[model samples]
Target: MSRDWTSTLVRARSAQDGGDLALAARLLADAGGDPTAPDDALRLLSGVLRAQGRHAEALPLLETLTRRRPTSAVAEHNLAAALGDCGRAGDSEQAAERALTKGGAAPETWLVLGRARTSQGKLAQAEDAFRQALAQRPDFLPAYRDLAQLLWMQDGDLTRMTQAVAPLAALAGVREDAALLYATILRDTAGDGAALQSLAAWVERGSVEAALAAAAAASGLDPRLALQHAQRAQAQAPHDQRARLAVLTALIAAGRAELATAGLEDHLRRDPGDQHARALLLTAWRLVDDPRALTTEDYARLVRTYRLAEDDAADRGAWLARTAAALRRLHPFRSHPFQQSIQHGAQSMIDPRAAGDPDIDRLFEALRAPIDAYIADVRPGGLAPTAGGWSMSGAWSVKLKAGGLHTDHVHPRAWVSSAAYIETPPTVEAGGHEGWLRFGAARIGAAFALPAQHWVRPEPGTLVLFPSYLWHGTEPFSGSGERLTVAFDLQPA
Candidate 1:
């Protein structure tokens, strides 16, 4: 039996080396006679599943392996990686620390630790972990990627960003992910011209990955070029979903929203139940000036039913004031890059449930009725049909000072989105609509030519709910007082 298991493990390794992961997993799972076979099978099979992005499937096996071999640094590292991939960032970080304590020195383990820290909004710690990984293995590609992404997320000075990425960017073909990150930083900070020059040079070799990266970089800077590169990516990998999404995104960004309708319609025809595509289609309708996208009746429905009721509270004004104060106290006010609208300001990480403020918690509870009403009334027909209950996948508070504004963008992951004005800036210019929410404009630098279709004046104690795909941003305001608001996303259960 021992001989058979040893041979089976050897065969499994051979299969994995030959890129037959399915065969490797099957062989490992079936080799169960010997006592050590289970451990070997669990270890190998977890790796196989994780490589395939089946992290949920890999998690239980890794957990069991970790329990069986608590002292094995490799097992603990693998478990931490699985946990990170499955979105258990806090747990994954703890497990990764245990892996390090158990003497794990693999660059991949450090990369996992870095990613787990990133998810938990620990940017400095994440950067250190990634740097540590790179220090151990200079040629490690994953470490380069993790480090570059972490650095890009920080609103650090231009010199700091350039210094960190200069060494890695100097070696382009060696690490494609790092090169892409470098291009993104340049595109966002310097100008479209500089980023396009670098991206264009990189994609001249006609690689699909390079083309995809170029498409992303050119997305807002040069929509035509973005479309061309996205089309190239689609041509190279016709069935790739990312390529398809890029094409759709480029079409909208290029000010050719009318042309995007057909592509979205065709995609929906093939995959009727794709919620993301459906949401994009809804936004496309609005972009092309279609009335069916968001009619007067829809706006009326939102106005009538969506905003949270003030009558539910004992004292509406006092409740809102206290809620705002409590939320402000809960967080240490960090500069999280996740909020695209905030600049020279602070934004809270997404997690209203764990915010530890009774007033804020009460406000979220008060928002349920309007959320339920929007699903029943305003949501488009082809979108995800909700059956009453919904989850707040993300929630955050934003404090924007003078000249601070959220850039125009859409929430791709949300089904329904909202902003509740917890505190408002005094004297919103009625003519200019400063500090008000405007919809239907693309991000800056897109040159998308279309003007905003709708604007909602901010009022304290009122919540405005809109489709997640709608491009929205705040009009820049000049004032001494801050504009504090709580935003949340609602996804169907």
Candidate 2:
């Protein structure tokens, strides 16, 4: 490389290292536009854009690079990731397929394909892709993590996930990722206690301690300890956003709203539209009764993005029938007002701890075992109460509507809570009806900060379990038919 090009690369690297993504982007752009700049410079620039969450801006550059170097698997993979981030799933899948064709089944390529399929709601296909990636490279940590997560979502089996990645925990190079993933899986599966122990062990590794600390902070644990660990990480890489976000969120959860406010303001001053900062700010405001309200357009936009529905009458009828059947099986008591309210679209059931049908008890036991195991393994000593003996106590319903939407809310007394989709309406609008489930918000309390608010689009076999107190609500259905979901809750035994 020429001296000027070398200098440009060095400057860009420094800016990126310092977490000055804007500066890095500007410098990279200047160098990239230079006809004499090396290909490496362009590649590095694309990576910086992606890390900074500017996938849209990075797409054309990555695309052009891939075109110029048709055999460049890295560029193609990057392009695929950018495309997926931009919500162009078909294009992303095609790009991944092309990369795999050229690279001959590389783990990275498979990982990209798996993620793309996941975003497209092709979970089965995505699982296969992830498995394919792992088959190619058994030690591929990312694929393992992703696959484990997918499995956890589907079956709520934390032990299986831990066993799947156990080989990684002892490998020095991959140990940190393994520890983090293991801790996360444990935290989510078993409870918070196991997660905390795993996290502590991960921190002891000395590499990426800051990242782990940040994760700890984000999980709403002791920020001071997390910050101390994060400081170690920042020493090596000053601008790690994951670390920063973790610390910032920890501070907010720790009730240091002033520090969080100042930190967020400073962050926004540098990048006014930082979504992470914006999310933190929203969370901080939740602590105080700040009446800064969201407009109708804001709610509408959120609803449209997350809701699911169908257009055909046949689809609607099918959905209702499936949902009704699930409800009847779950709740057979006719005299009960909650169960009697079963209609075409909505119905509720009551399963009390003290007294409930044997069938209902068995059904809840089946659901609780896997979930409890997962919570025990993942969350460990976290606040998740062991409700294995607890019967399904609270009553909830399946609400279906052609375009019905539910505003965000959290369950109050229920311990383990869930929503199982009996039927999904066909795709409609620009996409299919989203009417999916979304959970996580700081306003729900410190316990929810770690999950970082995730959206799961419901499918026929989709069943999501979370802490009842976690603030969650459904997006509206927009297709021509009703969406069907069965909601239930568990109480202390």
Return the top candidate by TM-score: 1
Q: Which ten residues in a row have the lowest lDDT in candidate 2?
A: 333-342
lDDT scores in order: 0.72, 0.59
TM-score of 2: 0.47
1-493 in candidate 2: lDDT tens per residue?
5457788888889998898988988887864456666777878888898886567778877877887799977778888888876656668899999888786468888988987776455778988999899889877878877776666554455577567666655552355656665565554456545666656645555667525534553344555554566556655566876556556666665666656766766776776434446556655655554554233343332322211233376764564464455455433221112112122233332222212345333334445555555455444214344534444554454545655545455554455567756566665233532676665433322344433245666765345666554456655666576565556665544
TM-score of each: 0.74, 0.47
Tens-digit lDDT track for model 1 on 1-493? 3556667778989999999998887887643333555677777877887786667788878877788888989888988887876667788899999999999988888888998887677878988998889888876766765565456446646576667766767766455665666566566555556666776666877667878878866765678888999999999999987788778868877767787788888887987645567656766787776867866565555433244545756687788888878767634433435225565566664355555568887888888777766666665433444555677766778887778788777776676778888887875744678888887665623656446667888888888888676667888888667788888877766
Candidate 2 regions exceeding 4 Å error are 1-11, 30-38, 158-163, 166-176, 197-493
Candidate 2 lDDT at 150 equals 64
